[model samples]
Target: MVLLSCLQRCIQLLIWPVYILAYMGLWDSFYKRVFPYIMARFAPIYNQKVCKQKQELFSNLRKFAGPSGQLRLLEIGTGTGTNFQFYPPGCQLTCTDPNPNFRQFLLKSLSENPHVQLERSVVASGENLHEVPDGAVDVVVCTLVLCSVTNVSKVLKEVLRVLRLGGAFYFLEHVAADQSSWTYFWQKVCDPAWKCFGDGCSLSRETQKELEKTNFSELNLRRIHVAPRWSPTSPHIIGYAVK
Candidate 1:
């Protein structure tokens, strides 16, 4: 028993570095190409389930956004620019991602959509957003990105800094399981493996809690389960917030 315990600890100790490297080399490439393809094919179905929620979000946004209906929107992890189709017309969209391959694809997609002015940069969450000015952006959108960032608090702070007062932060994310038993089991069993292959996505992260810690005001949050054909998990949190 003692030998087995020692072996387990040793193996666990070595997992993180191996996980990080594998994430950069293998999973990044796979996600850049494959995730977009999967999302593009299924976007119609996915959009249908979330239409009501999106309507509520847009309703609230329209009230704050004023008559021009033109807003400066920033998307943190604009993977292959799949979400661009959802943005209201007259949005000046700026997208950033660390993956160069994904950025190229995102730019190409942006060109096809003439309404959006594309700015591509190799930016990762928790890093400085020097290109975007403080209090300049009207809206910030993050979907399924908090799970992958290196430091959630830092990224949230940067997001808050960029948005003007009364500006909103829109998000749709998968969070830590609310049920402790299921959360513990997944955390114990899958987190290490998931961190390796899922690009630092933590199955146990409570994104709502993290958002609450930020400076954003009048936060309206909703939680929903997203049944994606590709993802094994059915319960995901989909909601929006205001800055």
Candidate 2:
């Protein structure tokens, strides 16, 4: 029985990579586009939880942004522009995504919200945000985005480059489990395949450790089990840091 179970596990691990690659190829074309639309269409069902969290994050950000509401905010991986509604009226917002398919959705959201100034561009990750000037942005916001980037360290470095001194970087991301041995084992076993299907997202990454290695200071970390948005069993980490 033990030998059979071990063989089964090994087979699962071996087949995972192929499945992940196929999944990612299909996801990049289909899931990435449709997922945002589905999320927006079903916003009412998810927004209560998502919005509450956004409100809290934005509130914390407001202390740094000040009374003028004149924040130069940059959002990386701004899919479907769902986060546009969360910003205050006077924010100078720029949203970027590698996928050009989201352009119309971004424009529509910007048009509806007259205060927002929109710029659509193809940025593969934070490293590719050369169009945005260094130390120009007051705040950098990333929600559920880091997992898909090709190189997280490069992305974080780029984030540091664009943010002004004392500026804040806010992020909401789901990462690899730390406590559960079984979950961690599976995350390690399936990461390569998972990345293939999930837009280069690694379930084993410790985002906080990456943040600590960056130039940022005053890191505030929070953990929450984001129920049933994407992965049913995964937990999420949300935090902000000063650059």
Q: Listing every candidate in turn, what is its Cα RMSD in Å to the true structure after a full C-alpha superposition?
A: 4.9, 4.3
What are the runs in model 2 whose C-alpha is more than 4 Å off? 1-47, 66-69, 119-124, 189-193, 228-233
Record all residue pairs in model 1 with backbone atoms less than 3 Å apart, i.e. clashing: none
Q: Where does model 1 exceed 4 Å of error?
A: 1-60, 66-69, 119-122, 228-232
Task: Give me candidate 1's TM-score against the actual structure.
Answer: 0.76
- The residue-level lDDT of candidate 2 at 206 comes to 81
Model 1 lDDT-worst window of ten: 226-235
Ten-residue stretch with the least lDDT total in model 2 = 226-235
Which one is best on TM-score? 2
lDDT of 2 by residue, 96-188 (tens): 777766677767777777866654345455668988888878888987678777778999999999888889999988787764556656566
Q: Which candidate tops lDDT?
A: 2
